[model samples]
Target: MPLIDKIAWLHLHDGRILSTRSRGKDAYYLPGGKREPGETDADTLLREIREELTVTLDPASLQLRGVFTAPAHGHAPDVLVQMTLYAATYTGQLQPAAEIEEIVWLSYRHRPQVSAVDQLIFDWLRELGELAE
Candidate 1:
């Protein structure tokens, strides 16, 4: 199966997680992107977050939350995406950049508006009592 290796920064504050929506896209997603060639996970995450959200992540504080494998969103069956999530404290205000059109702080109640993989993450967060309903 072809895998899309992506990273997501989970920023939890006040019972909400930082989420975003691409321009003209309805599904919400965590702010991050695919890994670049010859890039480490930390490097990819920092680059993606900075490019997409204008924030810098602390490399030393990065924490691997989970590795999620699911069917590629809006793609044909048998196609899968492998998402590796990292939660870390970031320093800087978040602003939508690059392909991101809207920045959203999402609680678990808004879970349905997110992608399949994001929903899975939200469920996991809920199970851990990290997300508010």
Candidate 2:
């Protein structure tokens, strides 16, 4: 099976997590993207967040949240996505940028609207008492 590697940010507020929907996409996803060659996790996180959400993540504030693997959304059953999640403090207003078409805060009840890996993330956060029922 092929694995698609990605980095994601976990920004939670009032029992909800930040999520985005890209242009022309159905499922919502965390506000981050795949790592480019020669980029570390921090590098990818910084770049992707700024590009997608118009915010600059404070490098020193980046914290490892968790890593999750699931069947890639909209892909072959054999394809997998490994998402490395991080929690961090950021500057500037969060807005839809780049390919992002919408921004929303989602709780556990919104699980069906997100991607496969994101559903796993919602479950994890609920288990940790961080996501709302």
Winner by lDDT: 2
**Cα lDDT tens digits for candidate 2, 9-114:** 9999999999999998999999999999999999999999999999999999999999999999999999999999999999999999999999999999999999
- Give the TM-scores of the predictions, in the order they appear: 0.96, 0.99
Looking at model 2, report the run of 10 residues with the lowest lDDT sum: 119-128
**Residue 94 miss distance in model 2 (angstroms):** 0.4
Model 2 TM-score is 0.99
Candidate 1 at residue 54, lDDT? Answer: 92
In candidate 1, list every pair of residues with a backbone clash.
none
What's the lDDT for candidate 1?
0.90
**lDDT for each candidate structure:** 0.90, 0.96
Off by over 4 Å in 1: none
For candidate 1, report its TM-score: 0.96
